[model samples]
Target: MSLDRPAGKVPLLELEGLVKHFPFRDSLGRRRGAVHAVDGVTLAVPRGSVLAIVGESGCGKSTLGRVALRLVEPDAGSLRFDGEDLLALRPAALRAKRREMQLIFQDPFASLDPRMTVEAAITEPLILHRLHRGRERARVAELLERVGLRPELARRWPHEFSGGQRQRIAIARALASEPRLVIGDEPVSALDVSVQAQVVNLLGDLIRDLGLTFVLISHDLGVVRQVADRVAVMYLGRIVEEAPAEQLFLTPRHPYTRALLAAVPGQGGALKLLEGDIPSPVSPPSGCRFRTRCPHAQALCAEVVPELMGDAGRESAGQAAHLTACHFQDSLPPATPIREAAADARLARLQSFFSTNREPTA
Candidate 1:
């Protein structure tokens, strides 16, 4: 179901200056260093619309989702949901808010308990929130049907269902609270290609029918393209680009954004391949974290970290905002012919060297 208009609406959930760091210490429990899991992320999920957070694995995409629910306590930042401070809420208040928000994890198989029956699984949240009893079992069956599963299947164990069916059960559990917001973390990535589409469409239907807001975290660009109203592209621990789905697919401003788009299969009529590995987050490159791999990068890109700034000329001048963190957004600057070319030459030479070194046996 498509949103009527994605702009001019207040976000159901908002994050400002959000930061989370994990501690890794020496043997004596003394501080060693911190993993910069999520760094200064600020974004929003508009009421009744889907906002997709797309990035490669370990970019803290999952961590950000957990932080949104206060599942993992962050080292710093502000989180607000419908005008209430999420972080400032006490334990009991937070639990009450939990009823309004729920997360659908990435792996259905891993998320569900093998020991519990489908009915028990979905009913667990009900019990935790004190929502049901003897007669409510019939309602559980209704939810299963709503998610396109048979009510009879509820009596079976998690292992009895196919991958797609198990995921349906997971969705049933997430909807148990009749939550206002649903955070799906790579909800369909684990399923077969055909199954992936079915689940995606199901989610879209649920969002529209229930008037639910979604914060989707995914690496499947195609899925994101299919379901997202707006998109945020992450690198390392920060959002480097954010814009409406159509605008991002068409006129991506950042070179890193362009290069990331390089891997999108179709599109990119004659662009180069994505050139390098994401640097280790522990000791990320100076300036733009993506500068090490971005093809159009210059010396200045390596020296000064560009902040997320919007181009004055983008499509949504009034409502939609497009922000890109790259100094070269205004113009493709001159390059220093990075050491990458030399490395490429060496790789070709090495491949040829190994080919020649192989003896042609008689």
Candidate 2:
């Protein structure tokens, strides 16, 4: 059933100066280095909205999502959920509070227990949370149908389903507890292009109808654009730009954000891909982490780190809060259009295939 509650203005999830690092040792147990996975990430997620964290694979977007849930602990920083300090909670308290938040992993196959049937996988959370005790089977069937699967399929094993079906099952398991906040760590990246759309649409319906707050960690700009209400562009473990989704794409202030949008297919000119791989987090570049690949980087960029500044003076009320961490955000050149006229027809066909055959939202 669709949730009847309306989204509130208060932030549901807040992260302030969050930092997480992993120390590595050599084969002989000698200290080697530390991987600075999530470094000083501060952001607010309002209740019942979708906030997407987009960037390249090694940029620590995934790590940030995991840290929020305490699946991986942070070395430093404050984590607050619904006005409570998550980091300050005791182990027992934290575990009890977990029902309010949940994670939908990227690899559906690896995330599920192979031995468990679809019903068992989805029912486990209900048992743990002790909800609908006498009617657990009815709850499982309802969840399966909610995620676009047949109730009869609940008895099937994970391997018996298709890639898309497995992902649907994973989502059903995550929603079993009726979490208020859901973090999808590259949830649809593993599926084929055709299947990705179906999952994306399903997620959109769920978020809107259920009034659930979502944190989507992904590298796909198209998927991000389709579902996100706001976008946060991450580079080397820090947010470089954040704005309403349309504003971010239409007027990207960060050089890194521009390069990502420019690379999208059918969007018009030559692909302006960011040069070079991401720097090692163990020894990241000084000053600005993106300076190594930014075409507009100058000597000052290397000498001083830039803070994420808002565009209060230049933008109107709603969009004025757009933030960028570039020293020369005002001087950055406009992006060259990258969409091709020839690609429009193909893009339309692709869109149609994914939009069709999905169950209507309740």
Pick the lDDT winner: 2
Where model 1 places Cα greater than 4 Å from the true spot, the runs are 1-9, 132-134, 266-270, 315-319, 333-362
In order, what lDDT does every prediction score? Answer: 0.83, 0.88
* Candidate 1 similarity to native, TM-score: 0.86
Q: On a 0 to 100 scale, what is the lDDT of residue 225 in model 1?
A: 81
Clashing residue pairs in candidate 1 (N, C-alpha, C atoms within 3 angstroms): none
Alpha-carbon error at 77 in model 2, in Å? 0.9
What range of 10 consecutive residues in model 1 has the weakest lDDT sum?
A: 333-342
> Estimated TM-score per prediction?
0.86, 0.91
Tens digits of lDDT, candidate 2, 1-362:
11222545458899999999889999999989898888899999888888999999778999999899888889999899999999889999998889989999999999999999999999999999998899999999999999999999999999999899999999999999999999999999999987998899899999988989999999998899899988999998899998888789887889889888887766555467778888998998999999999989999999899999886666655333689999998877786644535758767766665456865443
